[model samples]
Target chain A: MWCQSCREEYEERDAGTCKECYEEASETEEELKREIDDLKSKVAFLRLVSPLDLISTTDLLLHAAGSSSNANPNSSPSTALPCTPAVPAHRAVLISRSPVFKAMLENEMEESRSGIIKIYDVSYDVLRSFVSYLYTAEVLLDEHMACELLILAEKYQVKHLKIFCEKFMTSKVNNENAIGNYAFAHRHNAKQLLEAALSLIMDNMATLTEREEYKELVEKDPRLVVEIYESYLTRQVNTAAKDSTLQP
Target chain B: MWCQSCREEYEERDAGTCKECYEEASETEEELKREIDDLKSKVAFLRLVSPLDLISTTDLLLHAAGSSSNANPNSSPSTALPCTPAVPAHRAVLISRSPVFKAMLENEMEESRSGIIKIYDVSYDVLRSFVSYLYTAEVLLDEHMACELLILAEKYQVKHLKIFCEKFMTSKVNNENAIGNYAFAHRHNAKQLLEAALSLIMDNMATLTEREEYKELVEKDPRLVVEIYESYLTRQVNTAAKDSTLQP
Candidate 1:
């Protein structure tokens, strides 16, 4: 018989779905595509023009603290990184996108009154991207950028960008980085990344201790290492119980 | 054999695709659904809090003209529609959503200088819904609301909202209202609704002239009626040509 989709011949045992089902599936696919197009347009429509361009109405300036600045002299000029410029943003956009910003800007906080926010441990580039994401819901992410933005996203309670960064980082995780990622995930409350890292760590439990990250984790946070061992033991007990049931 | 989707038995002749194809298709569907969910989250994230509550930051006021007010006495007090209080909105949001608004706000237009825009030929409720849609990309619509919003959407060049309203109005088009909808669609430049309404009108051409709307349309705009007949004639000629080609 012919497969309606691929238009290739197939044996009876290899058949997938009937003609009626195939037709229905095709229609469903078309409908889904149309819905996606409509949604893409809606997303485009809803996305704000980045406040980066329109500083006329800006209510706040975010400075990237903990970066090299002209005021700081210990860092030599040639080797020192360029000072990160302050990013301009609107209070209304910030409040809408993040609860952290909402609180900071809405309540009579010092930052709200001063209209200046110092974001520590973030470079100017990352700070700019973070603010841009708040307005546009978009960012170009590499693993390094993803990790940086994930931290900022977590700090500001931008759940959408946090999940987006987490998904990217989780997809890039492997045996070498699983232990480190697992610890990072735990610290940041990234449940999805934590599960992915823990699952990879479990699958290669035989070499768990030999890894440099595992030893560092043991020294840094013994409780986390203990939790890993506890999870391994639980899995072993569940497997043995299943084996016993099969034998009976 | 069992149908994988419905889990029901089917004859050999009813088969559609192979097992591999079915698995691939299911995976594709899952991927598409995941994409849809991601887009939905992005839409939600980008969506602004309704400007109604953010009046502190609003830079403009929109008054719905032709609504109940002392300016027009014919609209009696008891029977009159309640005056639509002026809706406050952000200049940034206005400039982002509609090109007309962007042009008006950016070009130092009178409205921009005054920070008050008078929207002619709209009721207060419809104007409120239109502004809410600009902020949230959402509005509940019945057929009447859909038509009214479509007109506003067109006038403002809010293509996304215009398409959304047109789709809703098109779905509600039928034999009874096709002529009226077609005329409305033409006036609004709603291509999708216009096509849907036109097709329905052509299908019922036999009874077209007898309908009261047909006569009203004839008196109101004979050119649109002529276009409908032209489309009907074109369809008839194509059908006859296809039939003659099949005879050989």
Candidate 2:
């Protein structure tokens, strides 16, 4: 057992009261647990609504309680419940059958001038993934998608989306396109994306230069030079056999 | 005009050759501008589709190109477009109607939640102001809303939302509920919120002991002692005013 007051280790029997000090360690532990539970409840209650929600709710309550004559239409119908009827199957079918939907599904690339959502002159397609995630809460991110989304998120000024995309890209960084992505992120001022991509490239500098593109990429990010030198020695030995076999 | 490369101020007569520099800075500047424009175009192109849209587009492309033999209609169509058109409009209506909106319009509130939308486990009415901001992109967040939103953002694990709320709350820290909010943020392990709230409380501590709740809160976070002592003079004056008023 542990003395709750001082956080000292003690035998189970001696935990009730320290014979040497006569401290109420065991009693304090119970009280601490209760206190912790109380704090947890308070935290939970506070967590249930954000400051925005609290303010809005308070505003809503005040509006509802105020004279109806002065109440606005938006606030007047605030009490009406959301319509919860199931989305009709025919509506779903109609959505799928729509010409615009068919064109999107058919892979006929649409022009930017086509009346569609645009943020900072970015195409609607790029923002589509983020919007989709917001609506359905599902994400299917890949290396290219991750890189593109991070840029889109940054351009749109969606901080949460940018962070999420950066995190996703961080995990997907590999020998394939880490350098290119890092350079692109750096140039575009996608700081988080750049840092993550650089870290990934730096961590795997050994197997990188086997690819010609990676070698060129390494020159721009000079921090990868030390790791490249170390990996070159081992790689030379492995490639020596192939060099001799190819000798005509 | 200034040389873009060397930052040398020069007259138009010195255009062709700079006596100090080897390369013409104008050429470099033009090249850089062209590069910037190209990057902007690329960014714009990438932003057109979102990750979700990209995934669907990729799937559509693969199927259309006859590269993937297992092109199932059900799987492809369902994941294509993520959001409903009416969501943004609904959000706009919600924001225009809220009391927080009224308060903001009347300039009763200062800063407000921007861009980010917060989710909560409370009544939809509670989320009115937040949702409204998402739709109309305008809000006037007060001190109370700021603090409450910090708690809510932390609870929901919305990083960006939490950051914004904490920032707003931190700016409003006077001798009032700063200590209480600080303690609450600390207890809840909202590090950023705690830091911001604590810094505010610590800056004005003298009046802290007047409120038993604030005193207890300060006791829990003893780091605020220095600020509390500094504010003691202000607290004394306020106390004197109360005492003189009571005598009359």
Candidate 3:
């Protein structure tokens, strides 16, 4: 018979859905597309003009605290990376986006009073991207940038950015980086990334001890390495129980 | 053959799609749904805490100008309707959401200087809902509220909110209210709502002149009524052209 969709002939065993169901599915798809278009427009509307564009409204300056003396290649020798021009942002926007910022700004903290926030352990570029993400909910991220932003997102309790970075990292997870990613995820409480990385590690358990990351993790945090073994043992027991049930 | 979607047996002629096409479509649907979920989360993240919740951060106050003097049933006698509390808002949010507000605030306008904007001809409830929508991109709307907000949205040049209101009003349009909605939509420059209402009006051309709204519309805006007749005439011409071609 001729298929309504794709206009192809299919054998009886290769048939998918009935004509009524196909029509219903098409309607559902159209409705879903309409909803997506509406949401995209909303996202565009809600997006604030990046503080980078308009400095007049900025109420706070964020400095990358530890980057000044790094002598980074991204910075010129004369500029001394530390004074890399601070990212300007609005207090209201910061407060709305991050609970850490809200509490710090709302209280009589030095940063609140001085209108300057020093973000520790972040490079100037990363800090700029992080602050930009707060305003626009967007960032062009590589794996390194994703990991860096994930740490910042976690530290500031920006759940949305954290999830975004975690998802990116999770997608990039593989056999080689699984151990390292698993360790990073554990440290940052990235459950999704942790699960993805751990699943990859478990799938290649035969080579688990051969990886340098696994050895480094074992040395750095023996407890994390033990947890991996525990999970592997549990998975083995579960599989064995399932196999026994099937035999019975 | 058994239909995969509904698990129902179907005749040979009732087939919808081949298995490969069905699987691909299902995957596409899943991907679309995931995209929608991501967009929804982004919207939620970008949405600000309503200005009413945090007045300390608010830099502007909006008054319902004509509402205070109206001693309508909606307001209590003791309050005299004039003392309706002003809706507090943030200038950054207002500017980002509406071009009218952006220009007014960015310039040295009286409202910008005074930190107070008086929205003309809107009730206290509608004004509050309007400001709330500015922050959250959401509103609980009935027909009356939708119309009121649509007018305010148009006045303020909040295109997102205006489109939202227009979509709501367009969905509610029918033969009974088509004439009134058409007039309202035309005034607000709501093209979608106008077209929907006009289409309904044209479809019921036989009963158009008999309706009380038709008489009211003719009395109120004879030009709009004339346009409706013009559209009907054009439709008749196009139908005749098509019919004549088919006959040949």
Give each model's whole-structure lDDT.
0.87, 0.43, 0.88
Fnat of candidate 3 is 0.75
lDDT of 1 by residue, B83-143 (tens): 5688999888888899899888877789989888888778889999999999999999999
The window of 10 residues in a row where model 1 chain B has the poorest summed lDDT is B67-76
Question: What are the clashing pairs of model 3?
Answer: A68-A82, B68-B82
Two-way DockQ contest, 2 vs 3, winner: 3
Candidate 2 per-residue lDDT, tens place, A1-248, comes to: 44333445544323232222122322433555554544333222221112132233221110112222343333337543122211111111111223333353345334212312113322334444544443222358877676666765555454445666676776666667677767677656767766676666656755666866676766667654554455555566768988999999
| TM-scores for the candidates | 0.91, 0.27, 0.90
Write out the backbone clash pairs for model 1. A16-B17, A16-B18, A17-B16, A18-B16
Docking class of 2: incorrect
Q: Give the poorly placed runs of model 1, Cα more than 4 Å off.
A: A67-83, B67-83
Better of 2 and 3 by lDDT: 3
* DockQ of candidate model 2: 0.01
**How many clashes would you count in candidate 1?**
4
Taking chain A of model 1 alone, its TM-score versus the true chain A equals 0.90
